[model samples]
Target: AQSVAQPEDQVNVAEGNPLTVKCTYSVSGNPYLFWYVQYPNRGLQFLLKYITGDNLIKGSYGFEAEFNKSQTSFHLKKPSALVSDSALYFCAVRDLTDKLIFGTGTRLQVFP
Candidate 1:
């Protein structure tokens, strides 16, 4: 079975500092990993994806993630944070049917 787990329910960060949100997955085949963000009253917006090659992948809004095959982890990171970056973050895995199974959703509160 394929699944993605985000153990944290929330993460707090001050503006202009580095930030990260943890993610890990299990899949039967090569996984297609994805990150997305949601603002109040809005649907999720795609941040990035890792299909193949390059364990380290960069994404939108100055975010990036390292895909670790051995550890079965894909942790998101950002060099510096912004207050506007505050939102609900989700880590998902592409299922066999091309559907996404999302985490419960992590609330990222970026204090100014």
Candidate 2:
């Protein structure tokens, strides 16, 4: 069994500031992690994935996440935040059954 946790319910940041949404997972074997963003009442959009290779993985919309195996964490990051970046972010990990188990979601709000 695998599960993801997003401790923050909401993250508020000013424009131009770096932002991060935390995620942690627990799984039996190799873990396949993914990040997705969703606008109001919309479907989740694929951001990035960490299946193998470099620990740091980049994705759409100038987003990146670091895969920390020892910590069992994959925290999403952005160099400089934008007001348009505000959205609901989700983290998911593939379970043994090959199903995506998603987090409760963390709402991000970027203000000018």
Question: Residue by residue across 36-104, what tens digits does model 2's lDDT show?
Answer: 999998899999999988999999999999999999999999999999999999999999888999999
The collision pairs in model 2 are none
TM-score of each: 0.96, 0.98
Winner by lDDT: 2
- Name the regions of candidate 1 deviating beyond 4 angstroms: none
Which pairs in model 1 have colliding backbones?
none
lDDT of 1 by residue, 1-112 (tens): 7899998899999998899999999999899999999999999999999999999999999999999999999888998899999999999999999899987788888899
